[model samples]
Target chain A: MTMTATTDRTLPDPADRRAAAHAFIAGQARWRWPEAVFWLVAAASLVIFPHSLVLAAQVLIAGLFALSLDLILGLGGIVSLGHAAFFGLGAYTAGLLAAHGWNEPLTGLVAAGLVAGLVGFATSFIVVRLKGIALLMVTMGVALLLHEVAQKAHAITGGDDGLQGISMAPILGLFSFDLYGRTAFIYTLAVVFACFLVARRLYNSPFGLALKGMRENGRRVPAIGGSIRRHSALIYTIAAVMAGIAGGLLAQTTEFVSVEVLGFQRSAEVLIMLVLGGAGLLYGGFVGAAVFLVARQILSGIDQTYWFFWLGLMLVLVVLFARNGLLGGAKALLARWRRA
Target chain B: MLLSLANILFNGVAYGMLLFLIAVGLSVTMGLMGFANLAHGAFAMLGGYVTATLMAKAGWPFFATLPAAFVLVALASLVLERALYRRLYRAGELDQVLLTIGVVFMAVAGATFVWGPSQAPIRVPAYLTGTVAIGPFDWGVYRLFLIAMGALVTLALIVGLERTRFGAMIRAAVDNPRMATGLGINVDRVFSITFMLGSGLAGLGGALGVNLIGLDPSFPIKYLVYFLIVVAVGGLGSIKGSLIAAIVLGVCDVAGKYYLPDTGAFIIYVIMVSLLLWRPLGLFGRR
Candidate 1:
């Protein structure tokens, strides 16, 4: 880490600049190793833990969902408890296309992303100016509007029964989504890895740095020539696309879409999952979605009625003790142990 | 068509009054404490539930049960403040949002467990049941009662918040807690009192609102967003603002249901979004 930091400032202008470059490089190095390890482990798990492929696939989708949330909540300083607006919109778009005989999964996914992104762009104009609870409330109003439309309009959306008939033909007309869950799992995993790559690149980019600064001090960001509204709008749109892609993935795998996708609970669940894993940390989304989904699964299997109670308890605990989430908490403990 | 308009206005006023009752507390909590009380609607639900159970199941009279409902809901909120909300007082926006959301979830789930998923039907006394005919118009007596109650509360609250020492102290605390603390005001005590008062109003709204919307397990969750929108539009922590905004939203929403049936619910959201665009600080809210 020290060597990388020194080399990062081989052509620095000042001492502080040199130190910042070194720190940046060291942070990059730290991120790279774990990223590589996660990919390797992810590949190995596919081969070794094939029975859990379905669970892993769902985690990948949900992780992407959580990542979309982290972009706004973690980086952009926008706390939205109703992110499912884009997620559900994308799902419905994909589902509608598939039900209408669109067989190409990639095409459906892209279309879903575009449609949700467009909606996000339209709504972001209204949402960008407001801060704190007002922003949260506006986003929720948008989601609720979409939900009401979906529920009441039976002809198009099939209402509460949901648009059911959906079928993805194959990937590149090659791999079939067989009953064994292999094709579906691999497909989702690949999408998640691609999204992860893009997200990481974006985080380390100038845009991402500016967002971090904006979160820390909004006034300072603009003083340095950054348009806060533009940055917020841009990041919100990107997050919406990511959320849309996650929604498309859900449609491809589950082949079912419901109005509940746009509900406040869906948004709240994502927020909980994102916070639980750790926000701002890139891989925190994955950790949070995995732990939260698994816990919910196990608890539901034991008794479906008490799942909310347990989930609520976990949320409260995460807020009180694990402020940075599970990974951050674990990292802190590790650092303490090493110091000892 | 005339009847439909009348019906819309009637429903709108009734709906707005209940909304004001439920949301006034939320606005105060949000404005004063800077905490989002997502569980505010749940208190309203609890009030309805308690009132319904007492009247329908436990054989209690309407007059006695009404006050009892406020006391019960207020007590629950006080307990909540002491144990959970107080700890969350200084937390970040996300923490408050998530924690309050957790409270909302638990409240809904707990209510479900206790009351079951079935809708509970509640009614007012026979004396307050029939409609009052005005010219060619006949309106539900209960709805008129709700309107009267809202107007009375508005008048009382306006006088209380703007004129009284307690109101001045509360306002001072809201504007600047540190300054109020420095001035030797008991901020904590003030916070507790405000929370209880807000929660009691929500409870009252819930009890009165039961006749119109009935009691359902998901009512809190469904109406949570609606209440928030009203609070946002009215400006945070302004009782008069909440009253005006609630009535406007209630009227527009109900009218839309009759006039633009196809886009009924969406109309309200559209209006909210437009209003937000026009005045991000809300109609009466100051920066």
Candidate 2:
């Protein structure tokens, strides 16, 4: 036993090194069984209800939008009521590009993301300094400013009538956007999946951990040698890019854009959707968007006049009872059930 | 150009008075309670609707309906504070925002259901209508009345908050709730009364502002940003600050709308953003 111990101390075990490497990779990937199941369900839904692809695509786009908000509000501890600024900026950029003859989907999407990211980067210096209501005001102010600009710049934005004649080219120069929205759904799903993978990787990264730390105690982060401002600005820019991509997807799919994209109501609705699904968790955005859109569809169909009343009541109740949101509530129930 | 400038100044001051009336309560509640109530405008809308309905349907005079509007909206706000807002005193700002926004949505929908989603027509008394020549300028009697009311209310608020025994209790409660409670002050009662006063003032402002700002189902959402700007720029709890900020905003808005009609609200927003960036704590706010 002494000889074995001496040998172990003198020479590092190859098996132990292999196990450590495997553990590092696993930590990096962090893919759970449930995540795989979620992807499977998403794919199965696409196949099961081909006719509802348009609605599904919209839900996915909203999910991406909400996800972008979640990164700032949930993970980075930055509450913004104007994430629609990025989304609207992206939509207008893509819409204008398509209208002016750069109709290629991928190129437009990239341009949209880059433009939104640049704006976010520029504004983050101002935005990240404020907390609580001040932050909310500045973000809302930015969006309101953008909305006004869009409304006045009628030559490019089409004013209140909306940007028309945005004809998108085929995906990969092969599959065309169809009337039934089959290609749109597949294209959106692919983008969402790609973005989700990147987000998942980000959430598990060292930078992400630092953000979580900042959220909990911002002062402590700097004490621990983390650059809170840089991380926050970077995350804000990334989230903006994601939101831009979502907006670009929406514009491309619908082939139109409007001033309403930058409206306060849209920003409020996205915030509501993010809170409804859950925040903090990466999948919360997707779940919230799905639930909110579906619920809205059903509620409006039932009684258009009183749909807002119900929505309002639901929001109040959610804030009162389920502060952590629906996904968090569901997770708690599951945990309790397992313990039982 | 001189006449136009004078006209702008008069109109701006009148509009600013209306904003001060609406936003002073918001500033007080936010500073004292540390609660971000986005539904303050909803109460103002309620007051406006009530006054309009009473004037139109019940054949009440505009002056008579103002008191009724104040009392009714104050009572409504009281019930809401006791039942809902009281529970959320310790909740996070986000939750407060969500709850208040929900209230706003409900209020807007309710207003739409009752008022038919159109602007409620407000008819001022014959005496209050039309322009009266004063010195080199002709001012609307209603605008003059608004300015007078605004001045009286500001004086009353300053006296009440700074001089009265109840005001002392309120100040104590706001500065140190636990200490106030320990010293035998009924903090809850003070809070409730303060809330009622704020809401009552908001209602009065709404009734007064119907002609200038318009009254409709979308009134709350339409003027929410304006009210917030006033409160933010005025330094949350300072009535004097709100008064100044509201007047400045009113002037800027009136001037911007007249001079740069094509640009819409672009200039006002630029001013607000720049002001906020420059003085995040507000012009008169203390750390």
Candidate 3:
């Protein structure tokens, strides 16, 4: 009687699946208005203000960079100050490959991602062992060591003079990279969209949920029989691949690479961009990159040196007041305004 | 071969002494307060820049500007601690790292705005400029001066930290802050003082280091990782560990550059990794 009762409950799954799908669709429909409006505004801004496209491209790259950071940092609770290691590695790889007679842009880009992923995988073993500030210092040390090697290796990397001559054959050989950066912008935007979709999928996956649990309480995760090291290492590797792709895009578009690609500044800037965008939130990175790149461009144009003071004040203010970055704060403020 | 070895030894000791001066504070801060301050190097840069500008441009004497460098960096550290760092002490390490990063950005920008992007040569006095010979060894008097000054400071600091009441409190706090606080030691005051003291040393290092290393806007960043490694390798929270590690790192780096230029940085990492493998925590650091 008990076996028959259990079988009867288990066998009625096809109708149940349809009902669950309907509920999910209904829930999504409820949130679609706000999501649509946000994207519509983002799209309109890119069209109305053509210059915003350049900013958008930067935001796209920055988002990818920050997304990589968030996977390890926000999800796995690993604080890395040297994420630029992977980004720069990818960039240098792409640039080097393109410079040395590899005409296929996509192939070079994929190579860049693969190389960065390998480095990330190797480094994750070292990184996962350390915790807190010690982890940060060691990771940063790795990046600095790499940076030093890059700087001192004059023959291969072109030293401080920078590696300049990278020629990427047209994307799929049909679309030429134009002078106005239109093709580059669209290409980056497409890449960013694809990455975002994948990141979204991952975040909703079981592994991602397990990582979230680990971040909340590492000890608790172990009690539940989860291997925190393996999860953290895997996420770190994935993030590296994302950062590498971002770097590849950068290398391809800029057609130049330098030792500066791996400098502390690059690392620091990515961190800032991440914080400036709301970390853990999917789109916060893009918002942050846009705000920061635009602010930087405008401020530097006015007076290059004074821009730091502004950035410093902004960072302090953001930390103290906004805390959630520009978009997060703006959303809250708008909500309050509407309520008022 | 002997002369080259000696030369390497001399250069290593000198460089290590400078690293020690900068790193000692990082060790203290990281060990004592658990604060990961990336901007400490910025304080050093500030000291170098201030000393350079005052000594070179404002025509201040070495003796006069040396104290001024200490005072300025100390004040800056105190202000930073009070204004920003206090809020960050309880925040996660990532926040602290990022906040300091912001400060570094500001400092770099400010330095660039004020001094342009050129490397400013900070000249020592004529009396301290030339070399001094000891038997077969010829050493720059200024380098020797730096070593002597560093040793003196290290001695004084060791005595202060080990012998004084403040030292006892600091030790107690480092060992068990809760017990120290329960015993009526002002932990907050200790944290501020420790930060100031550490940063003061960094300033001193910067000012003194400029004679050898020169001053640049990116100077802080170049030494930031090195200083952190010293603090980390020496074991967090112990002044003696920092001192020993700094000197060891300094000598090793100098020797490596001379003996194995291709693998100098690798050697330093090897040492650090090996040390960690042996001690896990650090040389003098307790788990």
Best by TM-score: 2
- DockQ-based class of model 3: acceptable
What TM-score between 0 and 1 does chain B of candidate 2 receive?
0.98
Model 3 chain A poorest 10 in a row by lDDT = A24-33
* Candidate number with the higher lDDT (1 or 3): 1
What fraction of the native interface does candidate 3 get right in terms of contacts?
0.42
Local accuracy of candidate 2 as per-residue lDDT tens digits, A295-335: 88998998765778887888898898898799999999999
| Shift in Å, residue A256, candidate 3 | 2.0
lDDT of prediction 1: 0.86
**lDDT per residue as tens, model 2, B118-231:** 789989889998999989889989899999999999999999999999999989998899999999999989988999999999999999999888998888899999998898
lDDT of each: 0.86, 0.90, 0.82
Write down the C-alpha DockQ for each prediction: 0.63, 0.68, 0.44
After superposition, candidate 1 runs with Cα above 4 Å error = A1-23, A26-33, A47-49
TM agreement with the true structure for every prediction? 0.94, 0.95, 0.90
Candidate 3: list runs displaced more than 4 Å.
A1-34, A37-46, A51-55, A334-340, B53-60, B260-280
Worst 10 residues of 1 chain A by lDDT: A25-34
Residues A1-340, model 3: lDDT tens digits:
9999998887767888778766764553343466567556666655776865766676778778888887887678888878888999999999999888895778888998999999999988877888865677667767777787887777888867988678878999989887767778888877767877777667766687789899988899989999999998899999999999999888888788898888878888887887888777666777778788889999989987788778877877777777777778877899999999
Query: Candidate 3: interface RMSD in Å?
Result: 2.6
